[model samples]
Target chain A: MAQGGGRVQRAAVIGCGTVGASWAALFLVHGLDVTATDPAEGAEERLRAFVEGARAQLAGFGLTGSGRLRFVPRVPEALDGAEFVQENAPETEALKRALLAEIDRLLPPQVLVASSTSALLRSAIVADCARPERVLVAHPFNPPHLVPLVEIVAGDAATAARAAAFYRGLGRRPVILRREMPGHIANRLASALYREAVNLVAEGVASVADIDAALCHGPGLRWAAMGPHMTYHLGGGAGGIAHYLAHLGPSQERRWASLGNPALTPEVQAAIVAGVAEEAAGLSVAELEARRDRALVGILKARETVAPDPAQDGTAEE
Target chain B: MAQGGGRVQRAAVIGCGTVGASWAALFLVHGLDVTATDPAEGAEERLRAFVEGARAQLAGFGLTGSGRLRFVPRVPEALDGAEFVQENAPETEALKRALLAEIDRLLPPQVLVASSTSALLRSAIVADCARPERVLVAHPFNPPHLVPLVEIVAGDAATAARAAAFYRGLGRRPVILRREMPGHIANRLASALYREAVNLVAEGVASVADIDAALCHGPGLRWAAMGPHMTYHLGGGAGGIAHYLAHLGPSQERRWASLGNPALTPEVQAAIVAGVAEEAAGLSVAELEARRDRALVGILKARETVAPDPAQDGTAEE
Candidate 1:
């Protein structure tokens, strides 16, 4: 194990909101000794409930591991004997800098630290910390315990490398960002697509329902297995992605030029809200969430039935 | 079934290419008597091989039926006594217009005539047809037998409605495009996303491999089940999509403004090709395709296991 490395045996989770709680559950399920700290009143009860829900859900992924968990009210206590710290504090720059600085002062520089801030730059988040090299962003998608993307960005190469390794240890797919960018990589792609999706609705190109169908039943299905680049690579036939770029690149650029930039005016918002209501067909948010979660579980399990990632089958190489 | 449709007991598949053969397999599995026609020599051997492969794949979805299939050398012979025609001719405006026009003259005016053109607009393809109202684009994602989306666009309201019903009857999700637009609904959305993906690679923000992981693990997973609008609806924490737009729409627009527009220069193309090769790890295109297909089947079956759509259980009302 390197200076700030090795398999993460003891970890601290600072902040017990939905993201933090999910991270805590994921860590615990992976058999790590965990101490979670959150300043919110009734944090213990809420965190426990969230972890319990996560434990039940983790069973669907065929993951069952026993890891000790403790809830402490103090940052110092949470930092005690921790090998790794995942800071899931609110997405406020100043608050995170101060909190991370405190942890940096209390813990040894060898302990890897990652924040789950979706939008904040990692450098900015660690600006006040004494050992900024040990800090990075380990942003996860919603339902961190389930979805397997952990984007590692902005730290010393070693720290970023260790963070990526740590996440891989947790049976997650970690992607490295070479440079800092707004919304990172995935969100940038998502934002680009959603801009057009919203524009299509505003321009009356298609109803919100049909637009959703255009994705979930269409490109979205392909995307779940292969991404845009790979899908286009396949679309190129025997000549592969090179042929696609040579032949179809112009058409793609033309389509991009025509993409709309719809402003979300009150009327547009109302139209979207009404369209969603009609498409949802009176299904409540909770009902829809359950449905979505169930489908997610099934898809995840189905992917596993085929080829499992070699990393997923072995121990972490931290 | 409407005037143009009557539960479609007899169907014709013109131009026995990959798309045509797959469409034939789907129709046959659904118990429709299919007559396929192609003029290319040895097309019978190729089409049969494709359909046989499709039949094995369709069995994974628990679909099996005895539907007689006939191969003829002439389109007129194939169209004789056929109630529905799915034309998968070459994607040339002139060729498609001539073929569609010929079919229009020979077939009943009420029979639905759909061209499976991925790029050509339906309006242009049907411009020479006598009954233009009966012709439209019924674009399917690659390997139509597996992917469930059938994008219906650029036809009269009644024709679009009936086509949607016909596809739904075949247990496919048919999304209607309100207006004729280049690339249609799904491809336009896909093109928007892919343009950004290529830009990210060109800009060195991320590698092609990391970008693909960013999606297949992140938003792509959610998208497989729910579209972006609805996913954001859930993100609103019970307030639904309207609340999401009111709160987060500005952030989305900001991200959109920052999206890159990189030209697909030669260097960029080479980088993408090499990146894909590294990611592919020497798996042949056919091998990767089979893997993708297996995963797709698993996901489709898994979704069915959870929530059975009521429409999937009943006949379509055209």
Candidate 2:
């Protein structure tokens, strides 16, 4: 929504994990100066290599020469002069509180700090920060350089608009959760689906590969275009959502009745591992990651053209 | 893989509703001789227009000369000599069972009769058919010609292999569920998610738009390539799924505590409608459908080079 003269220029990635590294790379590729940091030993080398791989991906998207990237030794160094901070640190209430306090302490009051924690509440993370109003959650998927979504949940109203705008400046789509809860929106939805998927595997009803296949092959692609409510609306013909619920509701209700209770027992874990291993088949973890990254790069680039900027945020993750 | 001439020649679209019509058009434009039929009155004209739109899409895919189109007025007429059948009749069991029985009475035993039912069990549909051995569920998304994945669920051993091979012949990415369930795999996974989405909307945690924005902008896009299991695997780094479950498992469990039990009460329905309507803004249902179709076409064509075959039992439909 800009005339190309002004938007986000400086960004920071806190925590230097896979998601963090991807965020740093994405920010840099979008022409923002990205300062990435972590306190772990050898974090710099790890982030450097991660950024290198992401740059190759960014280059594939014709974005390698757009901006700058740097690795810092500490959180304060990462936050220096940064307009936006994407925190990807471990999802601990204590660590996040301490980190936000430090970030707010180091940066100007207006700087937006986003927690990349996939599950923690924005309120909890910014509890001890001086300007909690400026801190929010902008959770991005791993390999953020490719995935375009930025789930922005504000700690308080003051930060919501600015946080949303800052992410928009980053060339990322951000959805604001009016209120906070565990898993926010996307991850929570994903939790529900994963729970059932795991349950199905545990019950010997389906294989992990088959379960994934059912989604990516069927509704997953449908969801890539439309969400469940809308899909049911269409399925209803002229009757719309109300009609769909009336007719198909009985069927779904019946199916729901038989749906397994999501008990994550040891037996369930074994089923998941074996099922996933079967699903992985020939692909090693590294191979799967590369494959996922490559496909994700294509998907992100493709969606940049068609993906909506509007908020209708139900992800498998939600 | 087929040896020489790796081309799809013959295909059939049974039950010419929305999904059926889309399938007919897609197959025709893909250069396969599509035998389209439905029991409903005026299905021919509807099928014709649907094929025209799909032809335009096929042209977009540079497949102008890829396939031919044909429409028949009768169920047996469509199934005659067809290599594959995409049945898109009503989802009701009585209707599906009757239709499959009729289809089985006419189609050759070698031909693959794939149902387009989104939720009905493959075995149940093929239960009373004469050549039930060749009848498998080849469920596809709304627009079959565009979405790359085809959920191929073979009820038994013989039908499974045939289903896989047939989808391969059609150039679809097929994933076989080892067994059957109420909604098969995708819908079940999605149901879990949708149930929560409905809950979240009803609970006022986030606006419907924001929930959707979280997906289209974030994890939904990543899922276009990799799945939840793989995503968490990568998130786990060197530790793999084992590490992920052990570490994040507690967090996930905690979040699950807050997940509202799904309730389709009046208040919840009103809340859902209001929230979703806000997300839709001014777009009409037709407009939404058009948008979904266009995007689906682009995604499917772009990934045409990467789709797997459906002939093998394991990878049935699309």
Model 1's lDDT to the true fold? 0.83
lDDT of 1 at A16: 91
True contacts kept of each: 0.71, 0.45
> CA shift at A275, candidate 2, in angstroms?
3.2
Q: lDDT tens digits, residues B133-189, model 2?
A: 777887776667776567767757656655666555555666667677777677777
Interface RMSD of 1: 2.3
When summed lDDT is taken over every stretch of 10 residues in candidate 2 chain B, the lowest stretch is B302-311
Model 1: residue B235 alpha-carbon error in angstroms: 1.3
Worst 10 residues of 2 chain A by lDDT: A309-318
Q: Where does candidate 1 clash, by residue pair?
A: none
Weakest lDDT window of 10 consecutive positions for candidate 1 chain A: A304-313
What does candidate 1's lDDT look like per residue over A1-318, in tens digits?
Answer: 334435677899999988999899998989988999999999999999989988898977777777899999899999999998999998789999999999999998788888888878987888999888888888899888888999988566666767777788787888889987778888888888888888888888888888887788878887888788888877887787888889988877778888887888889889889988877788888788778877888888886321224344333355
The prediction achieving the highest lDDT against the true structure is 1
